[model samples]
Target: MSSGALTAFILRSPVFAGLLCFFVCAGPCPGREDDQARVLYARAQKLLSEGDPDEALDRYLTLLKKHPRTEWSALSLWDMYRIYIHQDSPEPAFEVLNRLIVEQPGHFEKAHAAQLQLVQRILGSGKEARTNLESVKKKKPLPPEIVVEMLKTVIKNGPHSEVGIQAHYYLAIAREQAGEKTEAIAAHEDFAETYSSHELADDAGYQSAYIAYKSWKSMRSTGPHQRENAAVALAWFIARFPESDKAAQARSCLAEVRAAELSELLGLARYYEARSNPKAALIYYQQIASRFPEVIQTDEVLRDKILSLKGAEEVVGPVR
Candidate 1:
């Protein structure tokens, strides 16, 4: 048999398997043993080339057990790591690489570089979410909700570099687009609250207010809603940077939310008016006009109130 194949057969034997872990040999061997190891390695390469990863993995494991301190041991382990990673088995890759790092602290730089690459694969690649976010435009494409979770991983594990901040910002945007309003709101809150000095803070603030308003609108029917909360958040956005370009947008958002609130009260007032309860309607109209006089609806409420008073006077047959 060839040297590589002979190694594979020898290592498969029970006696060799048991002795392999601690076996130490020096120099190019005379015959059988040298032939055996070469044969094993060659067989493994063949399996790997043929896409028989399972068999390839088993052979590598056997090679490691037999020659844990061999010069090529790290190479074998790294190959196994690559195969597992290629299979999308990050957990196993993580486990193996983690062990390798622990056992070989000298490999720290290599391990960390590998981690960076892996993070890109698992988080930014969008493979897990099954999306082509890289090639897709924001307006033309929809973000899958999974992007949020992926961003979280990147933010947690990636270095605290520009890439990290970018990850956080993208995550916030992705969450916003996925209609995960609460998470999106919280993410922006986190960004705006903690990363106020970040270069992207202004953009984040504008997007936060937009998301807050959208979230508030969607959750309006829920008791103790967030419309007012959204206004408060907008106020913070404006107060933090009054000169910011986004400040005008934040102000507009605040105005729109107040207008919505006033509109709601106006609707309620009309409901009561239709039911012939002018007193309750007046209360609602007055509340809207008094509390939110700047809203356009305030003028509409005042007109309704004036007409209601005139109708009441006519119904009572002319007050003196």
Candidate 2:
């Protein structure tokens, strides 16, 4: 049939006009572009599945250009993103994801999830760069504060999402990995308290407490005394997260922290005893005897001194 005859035949049946439009479009069909865009999306997906990414990309770009503000166009960007990612072209893939985030609006739940994945990719880009030892030999680690702010942004944008929960948990891990123990302790505490029912909450709580326990050891030589703080934090971990895998080690470390406290008390006691202040010395001696029997009572010589002190209390408090 000639073009005019075929057009007349198609027009006579509404269903044929509709169905044939999907297969043959001579020019722009303004009112039918929505269906055309939908057809393009489905065609692109099929082409992609058949391993014809180049053709798939062409169809996606055509849809995006003709249907700029439509749902099909928005959906096209994600498939384009997948193609770029599969091609190992991260720059385009990442750009497409960014476009999806900015241009997306409405009940596009999958689009929102993709946006979060972009957030994770961007924040972890620094870590990825560090993975290839030779490539990043001269590169410095991401500043701990910067990593922290990025994760905080996710929590602000999507607090209840799977991404947000992970971001909150990783904020502390980032701090700890960077050796910012003080900041790590603070961040971990926040995660545990804010998301107590989350799967990672116990791990967060344990990290904060463990950092508190480990920090004093390095600081004691040149910094202030933190034995009591360490002991308190570690003991709190055991009580609060008894079922945590790290709790067993925490219990052992609590003993070490108590021992440090005992050593400090012994120092103060000896200082007074050397100056002939036996009564003041007896007070700390009594504290050590009462508070840290596991540490002090094991030594026979120390045991004799405790037994000799008249004002010393014969108390042996077990560590909680």
Q: Which prediction has the highest lDDT against the true structure?
A: 2
Question: Could you give me the TM-score of model 2 versus the true structure?
Answer: 0.60
Model 2, span 160-256: residue lDDT tens: 7887787777778767767788888888888888888888888888889878777777783722356667888888778888888888899889887
Runs in model 1 with CA error above 4 Å? Answer: 1-44, 62-78, 96-188, 199-224, 238-259, 276-279, 296-320
How much is the lDDT of residue 273 in candidate 2?
Answer: 82
- Global lDDT of each candidate: 0.67, 0.72
Name the top TM-score candidate. Answer: 2
> lDDT tens digits, residues 1-320, model 1?
99999999988888887777546644545465545656777788899888687898898788777765553456666777777766666656655665565555666557645644554454454333232112322222223555455556555644475656667777776776677777777787788777888877877877777776766777738322688888887887788778788888789888888777777887888898899877667678768767776653546657666566557756875324
Candidate 1 CA-lDDT value: 0.67
